[model samples]
Target: MATLTILKYPDARLRQKSKPVEVFDETLHTFLDDMYETMMDSNGVGLAAIQVGNPLQVLVINIPREDNEQYKEDMLEIINPVFLKQEGEIEWDEGCLSVPNFYESIKRFDEVTIAYNDRYGNEKVLQAQGFLAVAIQHEIDHLNGILFVDKLPILRRKKFEKELKRIQKEQSQ
Candidate 1:
């Protein structure tokens, strides 16, 4: 599969809420493969369709493992996912594929139980924690037209604003 170009923050498309996948066909599968490839190519642990200029509720995640070779099976593909429940809370340094080279501590659920369809239209539920939980929430936010940077506090937000502006300037040049 070919890697897709990830759209950076402030792109109008990233602000648009993704549409749910209606057809679990080859096209959808192909898109998901490309998304995974793109995520790996960009060295991101997770990605959402909106981050790649597509308005679809699709996300891919592969949390880094302590033993790199053994982690190949960690990748996940979720389509039309819904957060069923969340419990407790944890603050973690979160980053986004859409917003490169930036990270900030954001409060998120320590555990999340979610229901989502697979690439083949089969349903699945996952109880996620730690980095996986954080990644899932971040990607879901993208599907809902939200970015991890939007979760930052006022002071921290201002700090990141300068970097974001610099990235935008570079993109336009």
Candidate 2:
């Protein structure tokens, strides 16, 4: 599996809604493997296809252990996920592969019942709470053309935009 380039924030492609996975085959599995490698290489716990410039409703996640290490066996490759139910609320300090170094406190469901397809097109349902739920919601947002940064308040959003401009300018120089 090879690592893929993660598209950063403000990339127009990231704002594009992803299309549902129409076919599940070796090709899809290969892309999932590469997505897993890319996530691990970047120290990201989860990634969506849109983050890598692919407009597919695909995502991979590996919830870290107590030691904060992720195991391959624990990685989940999910396709065309939908939230069946969500309840309660929790604010998490969230970060994203696409958003780079910026992190923000965002409120999301504390529990979620989600339905998704596996790489082989097997439908699965999962009831998750806490961090796992947050991770799933975050990735799903990417699939829906929403960014964690978009959840920020107006003042914070303005601040982030200013900071992003500064960072891009530095990188260009």
Candidate 3:
């Protein structure tokens, strides 16, 4: 498994909407493994295919649990997720690999039921709550070309725009 480069915030490619994954062959399986590797290497809980320059509706999430020993055991290889139900409200200090060095209190559903496919194209339904729910929603947004900062309040969004500009400048230097 390779660690793919994550697209940074404000990168035009990050705004590209992902297309649904149509194949579940070995190639897809390998790419999923690479995505998982990349997410772990970046210390991110979730990563979408589009973040790695692939515009496919695929994402991998590994919610860390107590003891942190259950890392890979809880990996969710979701493809083409469709939210079936979302309830309650939760505000999480969400961060993204694309949006480095920033954390925002973003409101999201506390619970969610989503229908998605596994790495092998096996349809599955997951009912997630709390942090798990938030991570799933965050990755889904990436698939739709929506960044967490875009969901922030206007003031915060403006602040992030300035920060993003600074980061871009540093990258170009």
Candidate 4:
């Protein structure tokens, strides 16, 4: 497995909506493996295929549970995932691998149920809350061409855009 390049915010390609994965074949497995490696290497809990320049509805998440020592075994490889239900609300600071050095407090569902196809083309449903719920919502948004920043208020989003520009300029120099 290889580490894939994660597309940063403001890249037009990141605004593109992803298509669903049709074939559960070897290539799909390889890509998912690479994505998992990339997400781990980047120190992110979740990653969407679109973030890696692949416009497919595939995402991987491994939000380590604090109580679990075998967290690595809990990695989820989701394909064509959709929200089955969402309820309650929680406000939490969220960060994205694609957005880089930015974290914003966003309101998200406190609990969520999602249905998805596994790597082997088996259907599965997952119920998650807390950090896992937040992570799932964030990654699923990428499948629909939505970024966390897009959920920000207008003023806050503008401020973030300015800050992002400054950072980009500084890095270039």
Give the Cα lDDT of each candidate. Answer: 0.89, 0.95, 0.94, 0.94
Backbone clashes for every candidate come to: 0, 0, 0, 0
Q: Which consecutive 10 residues in model 2 have the weakest lDDT in total?
A: 67-76
Work out the TM-score per prediction. 0.93, 0.98, 0.95, 0.96
| lDDT (Cα, tens digit) per residue for candidate 3, span 1-173 | 88899998778999999999898999999999999999999998999999999999999999988876437878999999999999999999999999899999999999999999998889999999999999999999999999999999999999989988888789899
- What is residue 119's positional error in candidate 4, in angstroms? 0.3
lDDT of 2 by residue, 1-173 (tens): 88999998889999999999989999999999999999999999999999999999999999999998899999989899999999999999999988889999999999999999999999999999999999999999999999999999999999999999999999999
Error of 3 at 118 (Å): 0.6
Between 1 and 2, whose TM-score is larger?
A: 2
Worst 10 residues of 4 by lDDT: 63-72
lDDT of 1 by residue, 69-161 (tens): 325478899999999999889999987777878889999999999999999999999999988898899999999999888888888999899
How much lDDT does candidate 2 score?
Answer: 0.95
Better of 3 and 4 by TM-score: 4
Report the lDDT tens digits of candidate 4 across residue range 1-173: 79899999889999999998889999999999999999989988999999999999999999876764326689999999989999999998999998998999999999999999999899999999999899999999999999999999999999999999999999999
Provide the lowest-lDDT 10-residue window in model 3: 65-74
